[model samples]
Target chain A: MKRIFASAHVKRLFSALAALAILELMTGPPGSALTPTAGFTGSFGEASSFFGIFRTQRWVVFLFLALAMYAIWSAWLMWGTQVRAATAKAVSVPRAASRTRPVRWGMAVAVLAVALLLPHLITDPFWQAAMVEQIAVYVLLALGLNVVVGFAGLLDLGFVAFYAIGAYTTAWVTGALPTAAPFGIHFNNFYAIPIAIALAMGSGIILGAPTLRLRGDYLAIVTLGFGEIITIFANNLYGITGGSQGTNTIPHFSLHVGPIKYLWGLTPVPYYYLTIVFVILFIAGFKLLEHSRVGRAWTAIREDEVAAESVGINPLKYKVMAFAIGASTAGFAGVVTASQSNTIFPSSFTLQFSINILVLVIFGGMGSITGVVLGAIVIQTGSMYLLHTPPAGYQPQDLYIYLGALLVVMMIFRPAGLVPSRRRHREIGLAEKGEGHMNEVLTGDTP
Target chain B: MSDKIFDVDHVTLRFGGVVSLNDVTLHQERGEILAVIGPNGAGKTSLFNSLTGVYQPQEGTITFQGSDAKPMSVIGKKPHRVSAAGVARTFQASRMFSALTAFENIKIGAESHRGIGVAGAMLRGPKTRRDERTSDARTVELLDFVGLRAKANVISSSLSYGDRRRLEIARGLATGPQVLLLDEPAAGTNPSEKLELTTLIRKVRDEMGVSILLIEHDMKLVMSLAERLYVLNFGSVIAQGTPEEIRANEKVIEAYLGSTATETGDRS
Candidate 1:
């Protein structure tokens, strides 16, 4: 084989051919039979299911795709350094230019101004609703989960359970659930905020107190079980949760404090404005927390628990704090979502929802507030767009397949994420250079 | 009221069938450098763990009395509580927050004292800002004390082995403990680094007035630095005296120093 393909060009050709064959096998027509009765007969000469409009053979379609893939792969191999250098220069130039305090402040204000004016720019009712419902809500979720997974390095797979708790708590307080409101107050959703937050935080502490002692995979498993338990209870507890039917009597928010008598109606734009205001407030608070003593304690705990304890930081206390704090944000998001939507089903808080928020956090650069916000907006918008106008052969079920493929590619190229925090980016870089363990970087393991 | 920083007696620790520490008794005085030397599996690290509340003794009393504070029982308390009681320890292996900057690693220890609550942290009131400034100053001072001020911004994982040991010491000092535990501080350093470490240890005692409890396999460094020495063999304290007394004791030589000519000879 060496003698036959001694030249690099010939070697490349052989590898390309092998890749094309594998691609053809995967995307081509299925086998005729599973048993030997039909001799496993199949042919790649069949018309492609994807290119049905063109009536093209499966191999022909796969061949084009394989070639395109090979082209990109080979080009990357040939010019990866130059591409990286060019991007570094492009990014660093702007960063260095904007390093001044005034310049940075100006840029931040510009971004905020654009964010505030977004609803006005998009007049379409469908897009506006999608903005508030999908983008804003998930942004809140990603931010909350980021604290648990990113800052504290705790893998909480049941994060959505807190969101569910928050929503249910709001329902109970607003007299929407089958159960009577506490104190029989039957207050507005705005009044339910503190109660929902407190409930969510209380549950966070309850769950975290026992389970936070388990490290890594064990903790993840316990949290996963907790999420499933919450969902099952929500589905089965008909008297309290209204079961699968859920509740729809939740009223929209209204302000009646001292002549500020504004009502939030069915228009999604008003809700979007409210959500953004809270998002801004949260971002400010989280940003402050990130650079504070609490943040350092979290970082120390995440990095080395024993060392953190040796420095007088109780690891369990900080881990629980991360959970409760993260949960409170989710609870607040739940209040917003529940009041805005009018009805929320147990089906809405699935394990997949938690994973989806996790994906957003990881995709955006787990510890970066701005990164997750951008990630949520881009991903949620993209998914909503697909639902609105899916292309040919793009089944709704196939979204995850595409998303999975994207994540795989992302992990390979940018393991630290698109907008990773400085420490995370450095950690991944060091791990790549073999100076640190990759498991520590990826899974937050001590090793 | 006791002048001793630590008063440990009859500490017996066992894991399953094996007794890791067998009725070990030891004491450390105020502003003194104490060394605990033993061969591998001599329960030196186990004793440190017990002192730090990582492990609980089946039968013992561990009391910590810093210069100003009342003597408090160490057993049954959490590690952080023991730490807050003015005891800080380094690890046998250099455990640093690898991804963080060198300054940040030490700052974590410095700011761990009198932590601003979550609300204050999120709000960034004037008090929080003042605390942060003071923490940064202390962190810088400690880094300079350890001769690592130049490497403040560097990621801790990329530090040299000698530098890592120094960083760990700086981190421990950053906690502002009255008693500092040094676990194999000179294990992986070169000869020149060892000399520097010895000087630094002495400076920590003389200048900072912090008592030192060290576990070391390096006989030469331990003999030169430690005022008092405790020898352990098979999980129990075999001998305890001044270094000169320990150097002459028959049991110490038979248990530890005699084997030193062959195994770990290069280390000394």
Candidate 2:
């Protein structure tokens, strides 16, 4: 009770009441007057009447404003002190390696359980399917983009080109479009997956071969052009791609082994399971790649290209390989998405989709597989949730405004992201330490 | 091994109109320490860059005598290719992969020589696993040699100045090169650290049979450690001889030492 009545809480409560009173006055009395309630007569009469009105409602408004200002000022002071204390504690604590095998295994098991139970827990077919198609696809895309941007330190803004190529490959191979099919060939979606992945990787090499030499912004521009080119091609190639109409009647994923046969239908639960399996496989593969020799080379190149070359690392070869590997994941995702929807459209492969995937990767923490996954789930599911059950006066488009604000705040406060990779965390921490050292030097204090 | 390990024949490198190296010629005999000493901007680093394929000389040929009999022309080759052909180099500013661990940095060098392909790395096949194991063992051995075994797992950026230089040398050695180029390896190091570096350089040459071509400004370190010396001035070789002869040469003293001929003065 004493703590509740402390200065801070009391001040906050008082400000709340004061704000309510001001809102009531601004809204006016219960019934609409339809005109000015206080009538002014002559100069002296008007002055006296205005003063009378000010003595009541206007004075309450002044008190409300003062209380609100005090509340905000006190809150700001508390926040400032708390931030300083947290920063001091963070700097003093030695970084402890927390990636013990048992802990990792526990996380893996927990994730697996969640993935297995998710379809059953969400009985709503529409949401279940939406979760699989929208969230899962972005998760896969984010993971792929993570390899390019986070692991290899290549800022690829046109990652969706690979995704589009994968979907188109599936559409062509599965004979989805009557006019666009090659020799009217029809194949299982499962069979088309490998072909789609191969084609995507090939395209990756072709695009990366010439442009991998371009660094930073130049590379990003070239990739953006590549993505635009692919979309333009899809839109224009009427004979092969069905152009604006897009390929439809694409076959769904099916399996026919000796004794059992299964076909994925309108219900998204089966597709969800299939995508979950691939996600697990990819996570394992990406984790393995992260710890391997290739991963070391990527780290070396990312840190310093000239140093990497002096040590005999062929930067071009490794960079192209990263592109191809990253593309392969998007290709797989594309195949899953095309099959799930039973269609592939050039309109579907927009630059916004690429940016959305990149946003998830950034939000989750680059170079972290689990971070990307969680980021995808949170952002995608959260946005969809808002769209379905928005508050009064809220629209689905408002999600972008919220996301933009969140990104700005994240960049300022936690640039390494929510679940940063160990290396990234250390890099950011060391950079901050350098800033602190500079401050000490400027102040003539010993570090 | 043959007597001649690296042969730089009349190499001339120019960027626009400024001649960084003007018809400069030098050589390193097998298993010997050769030092190139010059005043600042006197084309010492230009020569190192030429040999390492960072810059291709407009004229003359740079040759490396590998295990094979033929000397490979390395003038126009890529940097990685040059490194692959039995020559490795350390940077003047200690160019380490700052984000990677010291062990991992050395391992990258060793793996570059071992030649594990993308598929092999992804699959972790038997051959790749064996190669990785061998490289890891070699990395540990090199770290021990450079006296950085305690900081093997520490990030390269966090290493002390002296240790970072030593780590660069270890990374160079991990490439299993026939000739190792050290560019101001003793820069920023204290006297005791410099002594340790000198001893380590001698050990690398005598025990490992790796020829060293060093570019340094520290006159005392160069005079004490180098068996032979080449002095440069204004992008041209002014004197080349035994360290004792070069030290006594009047032209070298006038042009390079500049009347502050006290050999014990700190040059770095």
Candidate 3:
């Protein structure tokens, strides 16, 4: 019996069973928020709405549906390898090699053109706001977190803390908060940019200096604690931070140069353009750093610290640098967000926000610039769409359930993510073959 | 000014109740091949770790004399600092950045000596570009020197065992070290590969003019390659001399071959 249970097929079946249980638990009974009504009536009825259609959730029917989906997924898992192999053999030239430089350049130009025109093309003011709020801002957050989690192989759970710091710094600088600004003089929102970035980077270094010596899990726990501490401070420090009420009169960005004066107002289009410019600048800068000596050092340290040290690469220095660099991006993002909304709330920066950005990084492809950008766009758009036209029986709380399901599916199918960095793709491929170091995938133990 | 590359004096490293290296003293002459051979738990690796600044000895001092500089102390410095001070080493088990290609692996070592900071890398200014070009050229040169130039694009993990060992040597040399410590470079290689490795080691010492300190259990390789040998047992050096002199010594034979008596069974 033990031998039978130990068989690979049996183990796979057990995993499928586990997945079914979790999915069932997450999905629950398809109804409105549960009430203690005895009768099958109103919101408590078994017949609940889905996509504007009232559907009955009989046990037998739901089970059959879940089982059918599981069966198809299993079939794909079993047959996908052969299909992929057959197609690979049929295609003589590699996919990447087939796309010549000029073609790639043309594609890039087209993408930029679309991005530049997107805000103007969308007539709805709501979507224009969403594009900047839900998508662009999150993309910046994800890109910053990617440097820590994706590039440096650090699981930083306190990433949103930096964002909070940036926002609060902006608030303080603009005299929105009760605390006096530096030199006892209030500054415009634009002047807060450099101060916020410097403070965020300084905080990152301070947090990282001693704690980065801790390996994997301990480091993660430390970062998690840091995140909690920041939130608590923001909530309790009522005199300085405005506490849970948050800072409400943070001013919008303004420019005052010789013969040129402009003030950004409530219109989201101009803010979108400004954000696009910063995002482009950051992407270009990060792309350059990714292929340079610093990037190589991070990769080396991530791969093997001892070996990196032997080769004269100081591990702690690079790790701290990663943290500071990552934090600066988040800091700038905080500035953008605080100024755009003209109000700051401690509730907006939460542990959940950090995890959400991490999800974006993982879903997009951790270390791939293009991947994370696309991931943010797709996920934010989907979530916004859901909010705009929520299905019957849907609640704001149920969004995580769908996101969890999507992540699980992604992990099972494309473990490296939607558009994995080339090295990451190769590593995952090797792990599948049981050749490369697989602990990162299986045990969450980084080398 | 002695021409000794590494000067160790009565170093002791202890972990709790156990002593890994007990009052170990050794020295390596400039531009010479030295070997330390020992059985399991003989503290050869501990001595190497101490020398490379991975472990701090509880007692004594280790001084390193570069080609033309003052004899600087190596006892308290960190590994990278020691490496920057012209000391580089490899592990008993190869620890290549498995995901990186051979060229990239070498380039990392080559670029480590000097380069621009994060801001410069992000900026991609002339200095950063020039540094990158120099490292690239150095990587190619080292690849050719180790005769892995053709396989430069191959991932380090995907290379054959012998090729990986060669790649590691190439990587160590890329650091521009005055002294290279190799830990069991011939462990997993076949006889022909071992012969190639021996030639490569000699080439490294002769052409690059780098001093070598090797740790190996392979007696033939050690005897053929090293000018002098140190035999260690129970965290202490039992014998040290020219291989010819050490080979014929009773203490050395007893330590390595054990006492030729049946009564001393466990010791043997």
* Best by the DockQ measure: 1
Q: Which segments of model 3 are wrong by more than 4 Å?
A: A1-79, A89-94, A97-99, A429-447, B259-268
lDDT digits (tens) for residues B50-110 of candidate 1: 9999999899899999777788999999999988888988888888888888999999989
What DockQ values do the models have?
Answer: 0.67, 0.52, 0.66
**Residue pairs in candidate 1 whose N, alpha carbon or C atoms collide under 3 angstroms:** none
User: Candidate 3, residues A31-115: lDDT per residue as tens digits?
Assistant: 4456422112322234433422434443444455557766766787899899889998878466665478887778778988999
Comparison by lDDT, 1 against 3, better one = 1
- Model 3 Cα shift for residue A17 (angstroms): 8.9
| DockQ agreement of candidate 2 with the native complex | 0.52
By TM-score rank, best first, the candidates go 1, 3, 2
TM-score of chain A of each: 0.88, 0.78, 0.86
Clashing pairs in 3: none
Docking quality of model 2: it rates as medium
Q: What is candidate 2's lDDT per residue for A1-447, written digit by digit as tens? A: 777777676867676666555434433322335634321111111235533444443445555566776677677677978887888778654333236667668768987998899888989876897788889888888889888887887878899999999998888888876454556668888888899899999999999999998777778889898889999999998887889889778889888999889899669999988998888888888887888888888877776788888999888988998899899899999999999998888998888888898899989998888888889989998888887766432456667767886788788888878789877666557656652111111122221
Cα lDDT of model 1 by residue, A196-218, tens digit: 89999999999999999888888
Model 1: lDDT of residue A35: 33
| TM-score for each predicted model, relative to the true structure | 0.92, 0.86, 0.91
Question: Once model 1 is optimally superposed onto the true structure by TM-score, how far is the C-alpha of residue A323 displaced, in angstroms?
Answer: 0.4
